[model samples]
Target: MLCFGIILRHILYQKKEAMFWYNFETHNFETHIGWGFLSAFYIASIFALQVI
Candidate 1:
């Protein structure tokens, strides 16, 4: 899972859309769809590991 996440992050980074963050100056959120999906995947994988 970790390896996959790393690879996925790398690809997303190369595409210039890896993670999302708040834009404090604009008082809005910046969208980075890839990170959202990646985060969900990581969370689910961690939960599954804990269950098993």
Candidate 2:
């Protein structure tokens, strides 16, 4: 998970220019909230799969 996070962060950093429109248009709070929701959903799905 730590390696995944590091890779994900690296990819995001590398793709910053590609996402300029999104970054420019969205407020920081909104971006953070979106990421938070995505992370929560990812974690929930992992747990759900484990249960199954």
Candidate 3:
């Protein structure tokens, strides 16, 4: 489970462009909110699966 979790995290981070400083400030606030919502949605999906 730990390995699978790490792999999922790696895959998600790999596609993201602004992982650090410079591009961070350039992006709009809505972009960050969208990412946050996406992350939350994935997390909730995982939890729902576990519950089932």
Candidate 3, residues 1-52, lDDT tens digits: the string is 7567667766766644453232386666776777777767767756765666
What TM-score, over all chains together, does every model reach? 0.42, 0.45, 0.47
Name the regions of candidate 2 deviating beyond 4 angstroms. Answer: 1-27
Q: Is candidate 2 or candidate 3 better by lDDT?
A: 3
Candidate ranking (TM-score, best to worst): 3, 2, 1
Off by over 4 Å in 1: 1-31
Residues 1-52, model 2: lDDT tens digits? 6556557656755555445556567656677666666656656755665566
Q: Which residue runs of candidate 3 sit more than 4 Å off their true CA positions?
A: 1-13, 16-25
Overall local distance difference test of candidate 2: 0.60
> Which candidate gets the maximum TM-score versus the true structure?
3
- Give lDDT: candidate 3, residue 26: 69
Best by lDDT: 3
lDDT of 3 at 51: 66
